[model samples]
Target: MNKKVVVVTGAGGVLCSTLAQAFAKEGHLVAVLDLNQEAAVNVANAIVGAGGTAMGVMANVLEKDSLEAARKTIHSTFGPCDILVNGAGGNHPLGTTSKPYLEPQDLNSTVDGFKSFFDLDSAGIQFTFNLNFIGTLLPTQVFARDMVNREGCSILNISSMNAFTPLTKIPAYSGAKAAVSNFTQWLAVHFSKVGIRVNALAPGFFLTEQNRALLTEPDGSLTQRGQTIIDQTPMGKFGSPEDLVSTTLWLSGEGASFITGIVVPVDGGFSAFSGV
Candidate 1:
């Protein structure tokens, strides 16, 4: 079989690393992209050490020029991208609200504890929007072009649970991921005639660095917030990085040739449950 070339952005990240490894295991040439050059290289090196073809490239999601350069470098090393994973998005603290609800004290108290919606900084909002929405958009522009006439070519975006329902304290992230899901549909339609599939993965409540504070206590036990999340989820547990691999592989391979424009949730039924 001809080897496919897959590009996974934020390859140093836990989920992306797992996807990259899965692609390599299938004998595909993998490009590990990350803002952190060292970590991306580390993942690529591990793949190479395992006798797989891999290369690391640093590309900032917010920067078009960096993505262009990375695309060129990847082309020189691994040919065109068969599978593109937009996995570089996350939240900024400034874009977050302090609490879930609007309390009466929030109106009177001048304390910094609650960053009201009215006080959301413009830069903060822009940063989150740029990171999650624009970040995914720009990379698709840079990489998916090569997928136009190719078989088994697809784009997988990393969306959030907040996209399905608004999560509190993160209006920017929620809106941005909502945009991401909408854009996935848009791209899928736009690219459908050309054989390029666009889809997204909405992961629910993983204990990654993005949500570590909410999930784990200082001593590493589950926090109250974590327990609350588990109780709300039908599966009553968080997902492991490994849990995402099967879907990732299926989406990237010929098995999912007819599937496109869908955001698959690997959230242990968190999105399906209603806290009942």
Candidate 2:
């Protein structure tokens, strides 16, 4: 495979950092972008230390100006991006309900921290939407220009299993990811004439820093919610960040040249199980 210029947003996080390293290992020039400058620098430095070509860039996916600045830096350092991965997204506590179902008495209860669907914060919901959907959009706008009409270039989005089915608590995240899936299809069609392939990876139940507290106890044991996921997943385990690497590479590489507008699940059969 020819060495390509690959840019991965959210590289400071667990999944995207793994992705950045994997791309670099494959002999691609990588730009590790994140809102957190320190985290981005750390991941990029690690890749460079491992004998890969990489540079860290600070970028806020939500802000067009920040994304444009990062794009300029990446273009100057790595040439035009041949592959782009939009991975900056997560759930917000404020957008999540404390419980799955709404109950009659719960609505009238005076519990201090009780949050139902009705109690979901509008600001939190907006934040989730902006972070996931708008974040993906702005970055794509700023960087995809380099990919337009460029042969063998592609855009890979980080969607979630929540896009297929709404999770119990995180309605906002679920909806935002759904929009991402929809946008992926739309972009695939819109950019087809420009030679840009668009696709997404819908990951399931991965143990990352973002969800570690909700899934595992401090003692390294599974939490109740984690146990529920395990019971539901056919694999009976949470996925590691590395599980996504192979599929990610395939989707962004020549192997899947004909593929576009699809959201492939790397879910360990979690989406396939029906509790039978």
Candidate 3:
């Protein structure tokens, strides 16, 4: 395997951190980029402690200047990025509805903190859209320049099952992920001439710190929403961070050289079931 410099945005997060470590394990130089400096450094340090080469970088995916700064640091430390993983994305509470369905009285409801579809904050929606879609786009713009015309270079985006089927109460997140999936295809075609392969992984529900409270109770039991997700999923459970490692590695390596413009679903059959 070629030892490439792999830059993973949001590497501090559970899923992306796993991807970062996996790349390092394969002898690639890893740039663990995150908005939180401490989290990024911790993950990078852990990889180094395990005998892998990695560096932590602070970057905000939504800001072009921040990403450019990160790219400069990565270039100086590990050379140009050969593999870019756009993993910096998440949902905001204001972009989500308090309930799955709006009631007849919701328009006139006086309940505290009640948010319906009509009540969704515009700022929250924009933030979600920018974080997921623009977050992926900006990173590619900044890091993909190094990959142009380079052999074995690739880009991996973290899409979500919500892209295939919209999840209730989180229209902003679902729509944003859908945009990501669409952009993956667009980017794959756009980068084809440059020999840089672009693809996305539409993951199913994974139990990460970002969604732990929504999925599980304090006692480790499933919440109502989590139970619904499990029942809908053919696998009957939430996915683990480790569950995504192999697919991510496969997509990043030469094994998937011929694969591009495709969004692989790693959702354990969640996308296949129709709830019949």
Error of 2 at 213 (Å): 1.2
lDDT of candidate 3 over 142-242, digit per residue (tens)? 99999998899999999999999899999999999999999999999999999999999999999998899999999999999999899988988888888
lDDT of 1 by residue, 120-208 (tens): 78898899999999999999999998989877799999998999998888899999999999999999999999999999999887778
lDDT (C-alpha, whole model) for all candidates: 0.89, 0.94, 0.94
Q: Is candidate 1 or candidate 2 better by TM-score?
A: 2
**Model 2, position 68: C-alpha lDDT score:** 87
How far is 74's C-alpha from truth in model 3 (Å)? Answer: 0.9
**Residue-by-residue lDDT tens digits, candidate 2, 20-94:** 999999999999999999999999999999999999999999989998889888888779999999999998899
Which ranges in model 2 have alpha carbons more than 4 Å from their true place? none
Clashes per model (N, Cα, C within 3 A): 0, 0, 0
Per-residue lDDT value at 30 in model 3: 97
* Model 1 alpha-carbon miss at residue 159, Å: 1.1
lDDT comparison, 1 vs 2, better candidate? 2
In candidate 1 the C-alpha lDDT for residue 122 amounts to: 82
